[model samples]
Target: MNKTFKIYAVIFIIIMVILALFEVNKKEVTDWRKNFDVNQKSPFGLFVFNKEAKDLFKNNLTKIDVAPYDYYTDKNKKPHNILILESEIDPESWNKILDEVSKGSDAMIIANRLPKNISDTIGFYGSKISYENENVLKLTDKKYQNDFIKLDKFPSGRGFSYIKPNVQILGKTVEENNEDQANFIKAPFGKGKIYVHCEPLFLTNYYLLQSGNVKYAQSVFSYLSDRETLWFVESNTKESSSLLRFILSNPALKYAWWVFLGGLVLFIFFNVKRKQRIVPIIEPLKNTSADFVKSIGNLYLQEGDFHDMMAKKAQYFLNKVRLDLLIDTQNLDEEFAKRLQLKTGKSAEMVNEAIVLIKKAQDPYASVMKEDLARINSLLDEILK
Candidate 1:
C-alpha cells in the first residue's frame, strides 16, 4: 500500500511539472502579439472610431478589391470610380488620369497636390462649403471630424497655387497663420470627381485619431458611396510601369540623345575590358654587369682587338675610380694625390706617382712594361686602404 502511494505521488508531481513547462512554451510562442481595439470602418484598421462613421457605412459600404497596377494595366480593367491617396502627385501622373477622364473614363483622384495640368483638364466647380473654413469644402457628403487631427505647426513649404481655371472648388479654406495654412479642393471631370487634400495626415492612422477626423473620413466615403469606387491607397514605394522602363531603356527612340550616349559609353567600357588578354611577364636577367663584360670580352677575342679592348678596360676603371672617389678628372693626378692623402693618410707624392703611371699607359698597343702595371696596382691597393 505504501509503494502504491509513493508511485501515485510521483505521477502527480510529473504532471504538474509538465503543465508548468507547457504554459511557459505557450507564452514564448505568442510573446509579440499586441492587444488593441481595431476599427472595422477605417481603411487603416486601428484608427479613430466614431458612432456616426460606424452607422454611415453600416449598410451601404463594400470593400473594393482590385489587382496590382501592373496587373490592372495589362488587364485593362475599367473602373467606374477611382480614389487615389498619395503624399504628393506630380503633374505627369495627374495629367495621365485627367486625360483618361476627359476621354470619358470615370475616375476620381485624391492626392496631396492636384497638379495644374490635371486641374486644368477637369473644370472646377464649387461645392458644399465647410464652416470650419471658408476655403474648405466637401466634394462629397462624407465627413469624419474625429479622424482629422491637426499636427504641430510646421511649415508646409509651398502649396499648389495653380489649379485648372474651370475646376470647381469644393472645400473651404480656413484662414490661419501663413506657416500653419491648410486647404482642400474638389473638381468634376466627365462622369467622376477629383478630390485634393493638402494634408496627407488626414488619412494616416496617426492623425485619424483626432476628434473631428472620423467625421471628415465618413463624409468623404459617403459621397462616393453611390459609385463603384476603386480606392487606390498608394504604397510607400513608388512602382515603375513597363512603359516608363521601356522609355528609359530606349532613350534614343524618345529623343533623349544624351541618355543613349551615356548608356553606350558605359557599355563600351564594360565590354572592352572583358575582351582584353592578360599581360605576359618578361623577366629581367640578373648579374647585368657580368653579362655585359662577357659580351665585350667575346667581341674582343673574336675580332682579335686586344689593344682596343685593354684601352677600353683601362678607361672604364679610371672613370669608375674618379666618380666613386669623388676626385676631379681634369687634374686627376693632383686631385687623386690630395684625396688619397686625406682618405688613406698616404703620402701625396706616392699617390701622384701612381696616377702619372696610369696616365702614361694610354697606348695599349705599345710595348708597355709589366713592372709599370705592377707598380700602379700596388699604388691602387695603398690608395684603397
Candidate 2:
C-alpha cells in the first residue's frame, strides 16, 4: 500500500478502536419504555408486580393468554376476578369482557387509556396528563383521603376528562394548580363491577421500587375481590418477539449493536480497498482525423490558394446539401435557389447569392478573391447556422 493509504488505514483503525473503547466503558442507560411485560425488568415493566402477585392473591394467581371472549366462553372455567394490565383490549374481547363482568365476574383494568367503546359504555372519558413536578395522589374515600402519595417529577399518566354521575370516583391525582383529576373509577355493569385504573406506570417496577409506592399499589389492589385472580396476558409477546427486538430493548445491547454495525462497515471499507485489484488508468484515444484536417487547413491558408479553397468550400457545401437536404445539385438555377431557401429556411436573396458564388467557383476560368471566398463562407454559415 502507498503511504497515504497506510496513513488513512491507521487513522481508521484508531477511530474504530477509540469508538469501541468508549462504547465498552460507557455507562449503561436506564430503559424507560412502557412495555408493561411481566418478564421485562425495565423501569415500566411489571416484573416486580408479577413477582409479588402470588403473595398478594394468596397463591391463587393464574395467567390467561386467550381473549376474554374465548376464556369466558369455556364451560370448564368458572367465573373468576380478572386483572388486565395492557394498553387496550380489542373491541370484541372488551365487549365479551363486559358481558363476563355483567355475569358477576369482577375485573380490574390498568392502562394508560381506555378504549373508546369502554369509555362510551362507562359514560366517562379521560385525557393523558404529564406533570413536570411532583404531585399528590390519593383515594377519594374518607379513610385514605389524608394518605397522599407523592408522585415523582416528570410522571405521565391518564385521568378522566368527563365523568358521569353513575361512575364512582375511587382515586385521583392532583397537580399543583389543577383540580383533582380522577385516575381511578368503579363502573357497574350488572351484578359485577369493573374497576378502571388509568395509571399503569404507577404499578410498574420503577414506582414499586420506591418507598410507600408498594403500599399504594397494594391499596389499589384492595378494591378487588379476594378470589382466583385471573391475570390476562396478551397473546402477542412484544419483548420476546425476536432477538433483534431484545437487543434494541436493552440500552447496553443497543449500543453494542450500533458498534458492531460500525465495525462491520469499517471492515468492509478497509478490507475491500486492501484486497481489490487496482484499476489500470487507460487514456482516451486521440482523434487523428480532425487533427489531420486542421493541419491541411492551415497549410492551405499559408499557400494563398484562395481559388482552390473557394472551389473546395463550394463543392463541400453542395455535397452537404445533397446528403442533408436530399436535393439534386446538378442544376444551380432559380428553382434550385428557391428549393434551397425553403429547405434551409434562408432568405431567397441569400440562397441566390450562395448559388451565384458556387456557380462562379465551378467555372474553370473564373478567378476567386479572398473577400468573395469569405462572402460565400459567411452565406453558407448563415444558411446552416
Candidate 3:
C-alpha cells in the first residue's frame, strides 16, 4: 500500500478500536452490583422507593438520615413501621425498638443475624452465609402455592438463616439437595409483629431495577402490613452536604485549595525566619578580688616577716571580737577569757586557748611556726562559731 493509504487505514483502525472499548467499558464504569445503602441515590440505594415513599406515611414521609431511635420520639402518636437494615442492634436501641413495637408499632428488621432477645423470642437461629448462583431462595406461604419468589443468578452476601419452630417462615433458600433454608420469619409480640427478612440487599435499587425483581421487592413490602408510617433505617452515618466540601471533592477545586494552602505555608515559612529576634552575645564577668588578695598573701609568704603578719591577724581577731561580742578587749588576761566565754557561748577551755594564742600572736618579735599559725586559725574558728 502507498504511505498515505497505510496512514489512513491505521487511523480508521484506531477509531474502531476506541469505539469498541467505549462500548465494553461503559457497563463496568456504571456497574451497580455491590453498592448498598438507604440514603444514597446510587444503584444500591432506595431511590426507586422515593416515588412510593411519601405515600406510605400519613403525615408525608420526610426521609430520615439519622438512626430510627434518634429520629423517632416517644410521644409520637403515629403508628410507624420501621425498616431496619443492619447486621446487629445494640442493647439500648434494640430495647427501644422492642418497646416501641410492643406499643402498637411495627418494625421490619432485615438482617442475617438478629439480637439475642429477638432471636430467643422468635425461636430461630440465623447465620451469615454465601451461596453459588445455582442455589436459589424459594418462597412459600399457605396463601400461595406457587414458587414465584425464586431468587437466584445474583450475588448473595450476608443473608442466610436456619429454621426453627413457633415463628412463621415466609421464605427459604432451596439448596442443591432440595432442602429448604428458612431465611424469612414473622413473630408476634404484644400488639404488633416483627417481620424479618434475611435478604435485605434484594430491596436495593440494583435488584429492583432488574427484570421481574421489582415485583419481588414489592411482594416483600406486602409483609409490612400496610402501616401508617414508614421508616428506613441503616448503619450509614449522615453528613450534611456543604458547598465547601462539594468544592473540595472536585479535582479542580481541591487543586486550587492545595495551591492556596501551599502559598500560606510558604508565607508562614518566610515570616517565621524573618521575624526571629537577633540574640546578642554577652561575655561573663571575671572575679579579680580573690586573685589580688592571693597575690598579696603570696608576697607576704615570700618574705620572712611572720611576726608582723601574726600581729595583724591578732588585731583583726580583736576587732572581730569587739564587733560580734560587744565586749571590751582592753585586757588579754584569764578574766578576758572568762568574759568572752559568757559573751560568745564558747566553752571555757576553748576561750582560754584562743586568748593565749591571741596574746602570743600579739608579740612582734615572736617567731610563728606553721603549727602555731594553724592553732590560731582553729581558735578563731571556734570563737566565730
Candidate 4:
C-alpha cells in the first residue's frame, strides 16, 4: 500500500482503540426509561423482578412470549394468572384477557398508563402525580397503611384520578402534603379479578433492589389469586426495535460488538496491505551502439589511420550495397557506377566519384590522406541518398 493510505489506516485503528478504551472505562449512565424487559438489568428493567418471580409466585410462575389472545386461545392450556408489565394491551388482547378473567383467570397489569378502551372498560382513567419531592408508597389496607417505604427518588407517577364505585382502591402514593393518590385498584369480572396498577416503576430493578421493596411487590401480587402465574414476556418494546439497541443493552454483547468491529478493521488493514503492495518501476536498457562507434572513429582519427579507415568504410559500403540493392561490387567499373546510380537514384557523377575513391583506397600502393577520406565520405553519402 502507499504511504498515505497506511498512515490513514493507522490513524483509524488508533481512534477505534481509543474509543474502545473510553467505552470500557467510562462510568455507565443509568437508563431511567421504563422498558421493563425481563432480562434487562437497567434501573427501569425487570431483571430483578423476573429473578424474584419464583419467590413471589411460590415457584408457580411460567413465562409466555405470545399475545394474551394467542396464549388463551390454546385449548390445552390451563387457566393461570396473567401478569403484564409496561405494556398497553390491544383491544383484541384486552377482550381475550377479559374473557379469561371472567372464566376464573386473574390478570394483573402494571404500567404507567392504560389504553383508553381498557381504562373505560375498567371504569378508571389512569393518572400521574408529579411531586417535586420524594414520596412513600404503601397499600391502602388498614393493615399495611403505616408500612410505607421511602423512595430514594421522587416518584414520577401516581394512579387513577377517577374510578367507578365497582373498582376498589388497594394502594396509594402518600406525598409530603398527605395527599393520597390511588395508584393501585382491583375490579372483579365473573369469578376472577383484574388488578391494575399505574406506577410500574415500583417493581422495576431500581425499586426492587431496595431493602423492603420486594415486600411491596409481594403485596401487589397478593392482590391476585393463588394460581400458576403466566408472565407475558414481550419482545416488541422500543428497546428491542433494532439489533443495535439489543447489543448496547447488554454489557457483554456491547463489548463483543466493539471487539468485532475492531477485528474487522484490522482484518481489512492487513489484508489490503498484503494484496496491494507497492509495484516497482523498471527502466528500458539504453542503446550504446552509437557511442561505441563514435569512440572507435575518434581512436582511428587520433592514430592517423585514414587509409585503413577509408578502406574499411568502402568495404562496409560495398556490403551494404550487396545486401540492400542486390548489386555486386567486385569491380569498380563504369558499368558498376551506372548500375549503382540507377539503383540509388543518384547523379552518375557522384556514383562514379565514390567508386573511384573506393578503388583508390583499396589500392595497396596508393597513399591515403585525411582529405581523401573526407572526399570519399561526401561522395558516398551523396550516392547512397
Candidate 4 to native Cα RMSD, angstroms: 13.4
138-181 per-residue lDDT for model 1 (tens digits): 33223333233344332132234545665544443333533223
Ranking, lDDT, top scorer first: 2, 4, 3, 1
Model 3 spans with C-alpha error above 4 angstroms = 1-35, 50-52, 55-80, 87-89, 142-154, 157-161, 175-178, 232-237, 247-385
Show the lowest summed lDDT stretch of 10 residues, model 1. 28-37
1-385 per-residue lDDT for model 4 (tens digits): 6786677678777876787787778897877776777777888788887788899899988887777777667654556798888765667888988888888888898877777887887778757566546877789888776556666664675767898999999888877765688888998878788898877778788888888677777877887768788887755333446889879967767886877787678768766876866789999887799899999999998999999999998988999899988888887788888889889898777777888899998998889989999999887777666
Instruction: Look at candidate 3 and give me any clashing residue pairs.
Output: none
Better of 1 and 3 by lDDT: 3
Candidate 1 overall Cα lDDT vs. reference? 0.49
lDDT of model 1, residue 206: 45
What are the clashing pairs of model 4?
A: none
How well is each residue in 202-318 modelled by candidate 2, as lDDT tens digits? 778888888777667777888888788888886434335789988996776887788678767876887687785979999999999999999998998899988888999899999
How far off is residue 54 in model 3, in Å? Answer: 3.4
Ranking of all predicted structures according to TM-score, beginning with the best and ending with the worst? 4, 2, 3, 1
Model 4 segments more than 4 A misplaced: 1-6, 74-79, 126-128, 236-385
Q: Over all chains combined, what TM-score does candidate 1 have?
A: 0.37
Best by lDDT: 2
Residue 325 in model 3: lDDT: 82
The best candidate in terms of TM-score = 4
